[model samples]
Target chain A: ELKVEQNPLFLSMQEGKNYTIYCNYSTTSDRLYWYRQDPGKSLESLFVLLSNGAVKQEGRLMASLDTKARLSTLHITAAVHDLSATYFCAVVNNNDMRFGAGTRLTVKP
Target chain B: EAGVAQSPRYKIIEKRQSVAFWCNPISGHATLYWYQQILGQGPKLLIQFQNNGVVDDSQLPKDRFSAERLKGVDSTLKIQPAKLEDSAVYLCASSLDWGLTVGELFFGEGSRLTVL
Candidate 1:
């Protein structure tokens, strides 16, 4: 079975601070994804990292994948209150994708 | 382009009652997926389909949860004799089957269920 584990299951950060959320998987996989979900809302795609050393960034969020190590990371630069949400990292195993338990983030002013 | 569409945004029912959710994928997407998400947890895949054909359903509880995609476009998920633990959001997503981008999915708003 493929399991994805995320560190810092809950995080509270001050505005303008920086943090990184780590996602580690048990199996080898080349495709990983980052998604964000707000209270009572469906998930929104953040980034899709398809290869080793793949890195993608948008606004204050940057995601990278290291396929060999079976790990991925979502880094938030200068966090903002609006950035508060639950973040999840998923790995594609065959035709199925398994997601981490998720990291709940709260950005305080 | 319009994103994936789902209906009955919210539903509340008593245990042992049945419920159903529907979804329509984005125009031209060839793959569809259904997932169950509990509060404060990540979405869990229940089933996956590639153009009306079942591709994988390893995690689905075949006893009560059932889903089908008709005509390779619209899909429906049904849970019979629902249990209290079945309370969760049912999310539908679709992906463009262009070989290179097999895993990038477009998601719908999701249907939230409350089993009382």
Candidate 2:
């Protein structure tokens, strides 16, 4: 059984603050994905990290993968109210993808 | 090109009733997936299809659930004798290929099912 655990399941931060969400998996996998989902909406792909030390950034969000440690992180810099949502990290192995429980972020204005 | 498409944005039915959801993947996509997501949880893969063939249905409940991708295009998922626990969102996603290296999935808005 592949287990993916996320830290700080609930986060409350003010606008313009910086925070990081961590995802740790129990197995070895080379592919990791980050997604954002608003209340009542489906998931929106945020980043796909394909290799160890692979980092990708879009706007104020940055994601990095460390395959050796079986971990991934999504860093939010200078957050805004619009950035508030539930974030999830999924690790894939041979087409079997397991997702973390998720981190619910509340960005206050 | 349009994104993945799903029908019946929401549905409500009683226990023991049957319901079906539909999905149309992005054009030319060879891999399609169906996932069940309960509130506050990540999507769980129910079934996957590569063209007209089934790739993985290990997580699917065959006794009550059935899905098919005909003509290697649009697909449908059916649940007979639905149970209260079946109330959740059913999402449809599609990828260009099966290999993780070559594919990134695009998801539909999802069909929300409510069972009484």
Candidate 3:
């Protein structure tokens, strides 16, 4: 079984602050994905990290993967109120993908 | 392009009742997946289908939950004798098969079920 663990499941940060959410998996994976979801909404893809040392950034959000360590991170730079939502990191191995518990971020303005 | 489509945005029923949800994947997508997401948790894969054939259903609760994709296009999920723990969001996603590569999945708004 593949297990994914996320740290600091609930985070409340002030606007303009920086924070990082960590995702660690128990087994080796070929790809990792970051997704965001607002209350009552479906997931929105944030980034797809396919290789070790892979990093992708968009606006205030950035994601990176380290396959050797079986870890991934989602970093929020200068967070804004609109970025408040639940973030999830999913690890994919072969044909299966397992998701982390998720990090609920609340950006207070 | 339009994303995956799901119907009955919300459903409320008593325990032991039966309910069904529908989904329509993106045009030309050959793979579809159903997931269960409880409140405050990440989505858990229930079943997956590739062009009308089930590819994986190991996590599905076979005794009460069933799903099928017909003609490789639309899909439906049915749950009978629902339990309170089954109250959650049912999400539908679709992706293009690229043989061995993990493709990005497009998700629907999801159907929220509440069992009282």
**DockQ values, each candidate:** 0.66, 0.75, 0.73
Interface RMSD of each candidate, angstroms, one decimal: 2.0, 1.1, 1.6
Tens-place lDDT digits, model 3, residues B43-103? 9999999999998999999999999987899999999989999999999999987422757
Candidates 1 and 2, the one with greater DockQ = 2
Number of colliding residue pairs in model 2: 0
- How much is A21 displaced in model 1, in angstroms? 0.4
Off by over 4 Å in 3: B98-102
Per-residue accuracy of model 1 over B42-70 as CA lDDT, tens digit each: 89999989898998888899999999998
- The deviation in Å at residue A35 for candidate 1 is 0.6
Candidate 2, residue A23: lDDT: 98
Score candidate 3 by TM-score against the native.
Answer: 0.98
Instruction: Give lDDT tens digits, candidate 1, residues A19-78.
Output: 999999998875898999888887899998888999999999999988888889999999
> What is the CA-based DockQ of model 1?
0.66
Residue A18, candidate 1: Cα error in Å is: 0.9
Clashing pairs in 1: none
True contacts kept of each: 0.66, 0.60, 0.74
lDDT of 1: 0.91
What lDDT does candidate 2 reach at residue B103? 83
TM-scores, one per candidate: 0.96, 0.98, 0.98
